[model samples]
Target: MSIAKTLAALVVVAALAGAGITAPPTATAAEASPPRAQAGEEVFYHVFFRSFRDSDGDRIGDLRGLTERLDYLEDLGITSILLTPLQPSPFYHNYFPTDFETIEPKYGTLDDYFAFVRGAHARGLKVYLDQEIQYVGEGHPWWTRSQGFAGAPFADFLLWRDAARTEAEPFLDRATWPHYDGRQIGIAMIDLNNPRVRDYFTRVLLFWADPHGDGSGRDGVDGYRIDHMMDDLDHKGVATDLFAGFWRPVFEALRARRPDFRILAEQADWGFGEDWLVRGDADLVFAFPLRGALIDLDKDKIVQAVRETEAITQADKGQIVFLENHDTDRFMSLIDDDPARARAAAALSLLLRGEPLLYYGQELGMRGITREDGMSDSNHIPLREAMRWSAELDAPGAAIWYRGDKPWWTEPANRAHDGVSVEEQQGDADSLLAWYRTLLALRQARPELRGGDQRLPCGDASEVLCVLRESGDARSLLLVNLGDAEARPALDATIADDRWIDLIDGGTVDPSTLSLAPMTVRILGTP
Candidate 1:
């Protein structure tokens, strides 16, 4: 081996030996298990905990705040709330955990979480927690004890290397490891192959899934959104087969307890595929590539991607389709803040055939985006900024970014706070927020639109991408002009009944042909 490679191997081996990890952790099918992770056709609202609401007046959002908003969410037509990580962490974005069992104090206590859960359940809303089991933050007891101590119980918990950079080569900072999403975000990848770690995490999940230890199964979460759900270790041998064996057993155990619990995976790759089902047993995976198409406001890309997603997904498994989530920039930033484009994007995402997930403040056109000039880690904070409740600076419930008391984020490039609020949009019939309410309310009233097969009606045309969602005898046609000017697409008059009905505003459409306004979407149904 070259001197550098040889030295590297030695350094890793030394660290491992000193950490008391003689070998990799052992695994078995018996080690992993779940609550039957059930994801029925329901609309989801994704909320970043700290940014959503602050009931304590501490400038940070808490469970009390979340609980108080359940009525609002229910009214908004969302059936569930997909929360970002709430585990204790040193960072503002709590993807990495210092402790999994405890809730971040800023968010509230365990009692608060359970209360929020019970409250959501009362409102007939399901809640799913974001579970990122792959990474650990700086001060986690496991990391400190395993790396520095001689007899570390968690020595097998982390991925380490060997060779010649001294004994401390492998147990370095995130910049040196950069194991997550190909970014050095101050986190270290766990050695997921270790069955002991798997068992430990399973216990953690089970604890949350059934926090009350009661047989009722109502106090815990509906399921989990698994972060960075991967198949195996990249460069390592033997451990590459860990995912199938590890996740299956875990899921089996969970289902043994609660049959209806839902588990969704944020798989590494996002396209037409069912690999996550057979390999990892994840019930649903985020359809990222399709989401990419919607963000561009491209008619063809979005239409084709939706049709492809529906075709590829199996009956038992599904793809969670979304235009904006916590990880990506707000849809407002992507669509150039045009109200028309926002309306078009909302219709494309929420109306299409998939489990729709709407980010909090998405209805009010909440906007935030990271700049290219900023450091990579610093960029996501923009997208995760406070949920703007009102444009009024002194409003009692107005949100402030939690990075600092008063930071540089106070002045954002997008300036998302202007005129975007529940107060402003509540009564405005033509507002963007009003548009979301209309779309979600439509989903609630129409069973066909909720869980139906999607079809592209205007195959012969490219400028206007028309989609037809049908279930039983009920059908809805979504027409959008993807250009600056009007485009008329000729269709069989028989596609609709003698009279056409627009679901958004109860307007009428010509049965023989459709003329679309610029950057507009029309929902045509038989009246």
Candidate 2:
């Protein structure tokens, strides 16, 4: 939080890079001028509900605990929050819902949920709920009653195989239901082809978007992150191809009420999503190819990836670029505690032309990655560990409730002694968290950085990559030296303006003579 401390951290970074310290002028009036880009490159912070803050000393995160941490999210300049499912379920993760309408008691009552929505809205943070509509837990009434004899009333709710050709038979009456077996789950897939079943989910969505059926306009989420979406919501993996007919109408019906509402799809097979997602009415999908390049530090692939991202990312639809998340390995695993690797990757992720996102503890450089050691969901345990408030593992903010479920191979990316805790980083301006603050603030200050047509000026450089972001009356340059040695990038077109401001390093620069230290990132604006 102090200017002097930040300079000291930057000096430490310089020492780490093995370069001479040439301090840049600290940006004192970054907020003086508003960016030309509308909203100027906003970011989303994804919170794994159970791994986040906990209240009432339960050693488990709840809506109340999350509400208490709104200021922390606000300080990070996050414009949106994406939450995992909060509906009642038998599972610890709450994915397969036993009851779609009720909030989990462990997460708090419905009253707590409304309070959280109001609290987040008051802070100008748009909240998006994550929903898993594909299945219901074994304990769900739909599953319970339907699996019985004597003509189940809600038998049509699920995809069940049967000999009788009755109306209650599943859409895929020929194929049996999927093997409902997984760690912490044994669930039945929903029959999306059933009009009644589709209607049920539609109501569930509407309830969350606008809790009060009345026109009071309160206690609702801004949008939704739909889970495990596919074209064929068929029974037992059979091709029903109901998405176009079933999904389009659902989105259209929702938009008729809330026109500006957004929808994101977890298109696991993202290779085909570039074409498939738009058809399914998804506004955003995960960008996997570019992310792979970033994690490997492959500069050439990253260049091609930027081109590919620009090709698919349109005004109405785009990709959401993220490095660390609950389902995937933490970016810190690749970083291995090196400041250069972290800074370079961050630069590429933040500056690339797409919607940027961050996992909750990614700013503190949290590390973990699930492994394929012939184990199941146990590998995910490391990636979803508790937040590091201080150094002590048993500290108050460390909710180690789920730590008991950790697999044998689970390894913490960082420890309290590693000085990666928020308390430790809060003292140093040059910390990874501080750099994130500067990068996010820079995106807010420079419209071109967020809104411009991006082009890589350096052609096929093995170590250095330069992205030229240009908009009318605003121009900015993002340079990164990903290689071990020093690298200099040049623009194909000459910069008539010689003076520039370093948005991250807080210094002045001349683009023509600029040199990037190893694993360094520079965002320079024309002066």
Give candidate 1 regions above 4 Å deviation: 1-38, 162-186, 234-239, 373-376, 399-407, 413-417, 493-499
Residue 492 displacement in candidate 2 (angstroms): 1.4
Consecutive 10-residue window with the lowest summed lDDT within model 1: 21-30
Q: Candidate 2: which stretches are off by over 4 Å?
A: 1-41, 164-184, 214-217, 234-239, 373-375, 405-413, 496-499
lDDT per residue (tens digit) for residues 1-527 in model 2:
11123234443322112222222232223223222122325577999888787786777788898998888887876778999898887666778788776777777865577678777777777788998877787578887766754367777777655533132333223223232134334566777777777776776676567544332225567678888777765424543666676677777766766666678777856562575466787877777888888888878888878787768666767677888777888888776777779888887788777778899889988888675644344556678777777777657756666654344223555565687778889879889998888788877677776767777878654367888777886778888887778877755646525557776566788765677778878788775
In model 2, what lDDT does residue 112 have? Answer: 75
Please list all clashing residue pairs in model 2, or write none if there are none: 24-507, 25-507
| lDDT of candidate 1 at residue 402, scale 0 to 100 | 40
